[model samples]
Target: MSRIAKRFAETRASGRAALIPYVTAGDPAPDVTVPLLHDLVAAGADLLELGVPFSDPMADGPVIQLACERSLAHGTRLRDVLAMVREFRQTDSETPVVLMGYLNPVERMGAEVFASAAAEAGVDGVLMVDLPPEESDDLTGLLERAGIDPIFLVAPTTADARLSHVAAAARGFIYYVSLKGVTGAQSLDPAALGARLGAIRAITELPLGVGFGIRDAATAGAVARVADAVVVGSAIVRLAEQYPDAPERFRAAAAELAREMRTAMDAARADAAPAAV
Candidate 1:
């Protein structure tokens, strides 16, 4: 199994949801990316989603859009993000790094070329927000050939028929956008989310990761009850944007948030466990 599959399997066996944290690769600066990644893992992140800065990130909110702008201002191209992954893999080989971005950069470099380079850079998966599964055959086939999984997003409004399509195309895990608006634009209703997750689980047994609108430990714990994993993006990006000049502060803040989410998720799982008879 891939590192991502292994991590999810291990977390499931332990009866706890995995904590996945997201951060832009070159948000504050390119040099700080690797250290920040390591810090997140140390703070209990089971998987890492590194945003590849794009010129136009339409699906993102103001916080992440600003993050992309900062990274782009520093000339943080797709290749640079891949290099960061390579450097990160030099010490940590177990953590799965999924490149999350739009398709413009990947297409600019050519799908096949990007696939080879990303595989060599120790990237385990890719999540192109704009790449629908229907139009993703060429790139998805190439990525799978290179041993990299293709992750897809499922929104709250996705139909059951469409869920099957995404489930078949998806490999690592399906990321369910928990809200109707953009990232960080709203709040999550755990009861409603649980019902949606129930429908999704009926379609596919693949791990489901609930993201967007998850801002604090309390919410993370609530989502963990029904999700195989919890994904946090804009919250971490806000820290980078908040402490633009202080990389240490950015790293500390990101790690702290991740640790809090991790603790809450685990505690929720414990509370749900059945008592010994």
Candidate 2:
């Protein structure tokens, strides 16, 4: 099984939602990326989403946009981000890493070349924010051939017909943007989110990962009750931005938050689980 599928299956067996933490590659500094990834996994992250810094991250709010700027300032190209993944794989090979970013970098590198490079770098998935399902066939085909899962996002405004189309094109897990706004916008309503997830469940069997507004343990725990995975991004990136010169401190803070989220998510799932007969 793919690392992503395997991780989800393992999480399902454990009766808990997977914790997926996101950070921009080369944020704060390029050297910090690999070690920060390991720290997050050590803190109980089931999967890691490394943002490939883009010039225009329209889907993200100010925090992640600044993170992209920080990473880009260090000349963290897509190839450099892939190299970080390769280095990360030297010691840890089990955790799945998903490259999250825009399509401009991939298009610049050429999709075929980018796919092969990503697969070689031990990347398990790719989530391009602007790549629509209808226009993703060629790139998705290349990714699948390279043993990489082409992940897609489904927003709250998405129609049922588009949901089906996205389901058909998507691999790995489908990211459900918890709010209508950009990432970091704090407008999540778990009760409403659960209802939306119920509707999405009727469409496809793929794991549904909810993100965008999940900022802390409480929010993560609430979403964990309904989502297959809970993705936390901006909150962590904010820390990176806060401690630009103190990489170790940034790593510790990020890991602590991830650990808290993991603990809360596990407790929530345990409480929600049906009692043994």
Clashing pairs in 1: none
Instruction: Assess the local accuracy of residue 168 in candidate 2 as a C-alpha lDDT between 0 and 100.
Output: 91
Q: Quick one: best lDDT, which candidate?
A: 2
Q: Give all TM-scores, in the order shown.
A: 0.98, 0.98
What tens digits encode model 1's per-residue C-alpha lDDT throughout 1-277? 9988998999999999999999998989999999999999999999999999988899999999999999999999999999999999999999999999999999999999999999999999999999999999999999999999999999988988898999999999999999988887778899999999999998998999989999999999999988999999998999988899999999999999999999999998898777411
Please state the error at residue 241 of candidate 1 in Å: 1.5
Q: Record all residue pairs in model 2 with backbone atoms less than 3 Å apart, i.e. clashing.
A: none
Model 2 lDDT per residue over 47-72, tens place: 99999999899989999999999989
List, in order, the clash count of every candidate structure: 0, 0
Total clashes in model 2, counting residue pairs 3 or more apart in sequence or in different chains:
0
